[model samples]
Target chain A: MIIARVTGTVVATAKEPKLEGMKMLLLQPTDASGQTAKGSPVVAIDAVGAGLHDLVLYAAGSSARQTEITKDKPVDAVVMAIVDLIENQGGISYRKG
Target chain B: MIIARVTGTVVATAKEPKLEGMKMLLLQPTDASGQTAKGSPVVAIDAVGAGLHDLVLYAAGSSARQTEITKDKPVDAVVMAIVDLIENQGGISYRKG
Candidate 1:
């Protein structure tokens, strides 16, 4: 899972039905500090209740399909968890309330 | 899971026989000594045994359909797990063996 920030949402009317209720958000893969680390923007399937500016953990590939909502969909990068904290070897690198 | 490399390979004849023996390379999502931190090439779906340059661990949406060859198909990113080491705190930034 990579940390990211939700910038906005996308609506594709022609997408597969399995992707209907799912939220597609524009994400900037970030570090623990919630800053862009890769790519200008990416489309992600949101799950972590990620608001417009919330830090989130997004899962990709088949794992994104693990949810009951995205079964067999052509979706990638689903917000699996909201990053409440990140403690690598660096002390208290990030935290969320 | 992040860290992988497999510089070439992709064959698409017709379509969807569940990706038709599914060997789509030209994928270059790498890290941990293989270079390219963010982008340049992002067509993963290889596994741990990835040849032509190892170091891999890729997984994206729908869990890549949690496959015995992507059961539900429509794979996002496969190649899960292949990092030998990744120590932080600015000590041993990355490693593979």
Candidate 2:
């Protein structure tokens, strides 16, 4: 899993049949501090109802399909957990608002 | 899954039990042309006998565990297929050397 921030939402009317009604969000990978962007943004199915600017942990590849809602789906990424806080080296790096 | 080139090998004597005896290869993500480097290099279990400098396709996360040798393992990446050719816009962009 990787830490990311939900930056926006995607509205797709035409997609894989198995992905119908799934919520897709734009994720920007973040460092452990959850503030700075780390890599390219990716589209991911939202399983945890995370809102914009929310810190999240997402699974990529087949692990993204492990959720009940994404099982056997063609999706390659999923927001599996909403992060509450990030601690590194025994100190708080980020706290959700 | 993504396209990458097997750049090198990794020798590990201590690892997760399920990953014992598995060949780990260093992979560098590539563009569709398979020439330009796209992202940071990653370590992936070689499932298709990929050799050094071989252009290959690698699955990430849980899909990496779908292979027979890596099933239920802690590994997050696997080289699943060796690329024969990469065609984009109806033209060959890359071919195995």
Candidate 3:
């Protein structure tokens, strides 16, 4: 799993039928340094209810389909959990507002 | 999706019940350069029949569970397809033997 920040939502009108009710969000991968990682932002299926700026835990690969919302779907990434707090290296680095 | 080379197999006798009978393999992520990318090797469940040294296309996140072999399983990654040829950066970079 990777720590990411929800940046925005993705609006797609025409998609696979299985993805009709799934929420999609734009995510920026975050490293331990709390800086955005080197990569273009990824669009992920939102399994958990997370708002913009929320720190989330996301899974990639077949593991992503393990969620209730994504089961048997074509989603490549999914936000599984909304992070409450994070301790990086040694000290507490992030906490939900 | 990412292109990866199967490096080896993983044996886990004790694991989640959902993971029983799944073939797990070690994967080294490859970039467009055909070089191993920076990151620790990942253990992925093999949905397609892939052998050692085989270049395969793998999907991460909930999409991984979309395969017949990984449906509802706890696998995080899964090998989905074998690569026949790769045209990267406007050049034919790799061709399977």
Candidate 4:
């Protein structure tokens, strides 16, 4: 799993049939502190109700397909959890607002 | 899936019991040209007979567990194919030496 922030949403009219009616969001990988960018941005299926600017944990690859909604889908990334808080080295690094 | 180069090997005397007898290799992600570093290095199970310095394609997350040898294993990455050549825009970008 990777920590990322929901930056935006994607509206695709023509996509894999399995992905029909699924919500896709743009994710920007974030560091442990959830304050800085860690890697490139990726598009992921929304399993959790993640809103814009929300910190989330997403699973990549086939694990992304393990969810009930994404099962057997051609998607490669999925938002599995909405992060509430992050603690680093015994101190709070980020708290959802 | 991602393209990477087999950089080295990992030797662990004690690891997850399910990972017993598995060969772990260090992989460095590469660009489509197979000549530039793309991302951080990762450790992946060797599903194919990959050797040091070999360009390969690897599956991440649960997809890594789809192989016959890695099925149901506690692994997140697997080298699934050894690249022979990489063609970019109708041109050969990389060829095995």
Model 3 CA deviation exceeding 4 Å by range = A1-97
Per residue, candidate 4 scores C-alpha lDDT tens digits across A46-89 of 87678899877666777666667887899888776666665443
Q: Which stretches of candidate 2 lie over 4 Å from their true place?
A: A1-60, A63-97
Q: How many residue pairs clash in each candidate at the backbone level?
A: 23, 0, 11, 0
Q: What value does the lDDT take at residue A53 in candidate 1?
A: 78
lDDT tens string, model 3, B1-97? 5667788999999999888888999998775334555456888888668889887656675676777778778877877665556543245556677
TM-score, B chain alone, candidates in order: 0.34, 0.96, 0.92, 0.96
Residues B1-97 of candidate 4: C-alpha lDDT, one tens digit per residue? 8998877654443333455687776677899877798866566789999988899999887788899988865456789999999889999988988
Q: Which lDDT value does model 4 have at B33?
A: 76
Q: Report the interface RMSD that candidate 1 achieves against the true structure, in angstroms.
A: 13.8
TM-score of chain A of 1: 0.84
Worst 10 residues of 2 chain A by lDDT: A10-19
Worst 10 residues of 4 chain B by lDDT: B9-18
Provide the TM-score of chain A alone for each candidate, in the order shown. Answer: 0.84, 0.96, 0.92, 0.96
Writing each residue's lDDT as its tens digit, candidate 2 over B1-97 gives: 4667788999988877888889999999876567888879999888778889887766676666666677778988877666666544345667776
Task: Name the regions of candidate 1 deviating beyond 4 angstroms.
Answer: B1-97
Candidate 2: fnat, from 0 to 1? 0.08
